[model samples]
Target: MARVTVEDCVLKVPNRFDLVLLAAQRAREISSGGALTVDRDNDKNPVVSLREIAEETVGVEILRESVVQSLQKHVEVDEPEEDDFDNLSLDVVGELSAMVVADTDEDLLTIQDEPDSGPIETEE
Candidate 1:
């Protein structure tokens, strides 16, 4: 209780690297005004965090999630479902292509009748 050792905390967190990461994250939380799960006993943030881990006062899963969230720069979002607009656009393109084919026949006839004239310009 008076002194916190890595051996005590290792029982709760098996990996030394993971234990360091979680302890560091918890210490940061303490500095940022997060509530402590164990008695501080006038100890600093890191010591308090280690004590909490040793005593199993806080949930390891919750701490692990928090650490992962804090470290992540980008948050993934679910893509929107296919909508009516996509289908509508495809239908519009089909209609436009049909119209173009019909117009081409008339255009060929106009060009043959007026061979001397320049190309016909149609306004949309």
Candidate 2:
């Protein structure tokens, strides 16, 4: 109990940085009313989290995943199924491919959004 918990935790979680993250995440969970796997022993939340990690009472992989989930700003959602894909194919092939009809009997008319103007000099 007197020994440094970080040293014991390093044996279970090799990376010191990841160990810190996992320990911090676990400590936050404890602060948020998560059940403790080990005795409080008058220790703080961080120390209790380290003790749990060192004793292998909590799964390190689960802690790692939870930390990742907590840090993610955007969670990916499952894509919709392909049930409506047939309708999309039909629309693209038939409806979308039709040409616009004009008042005159021209095959295709040029639709200009803006009038043509001479090039102007810039004050570079």
Which candidate comes out best when scored by lDDT? Answer: 1
Error of model 1, residue 35, in angstroms? 0.8
> What TM-score does structure 2 among the candidates reach?
0.63
Q: After superposition, how far is residue 124 of candidate 1 from its true place, in Å?
A: 45
Off by over 4 Å in 1: 83-124
**What are the per-residue Cα lDDT tens digits for candidate 2 across 68-110?**
8999999887867574697788877775456333333253244
RMSD of each: 8.5, 13.4
* TM-score, one value per model: 0.65, 0.63
Q: How far is candidate 2 from the true structure (C-alpha RMSD, Å)?
A: 13.4
What would the TM-score be for candidate 1 when compared with the true structure?
Answer: 0.65
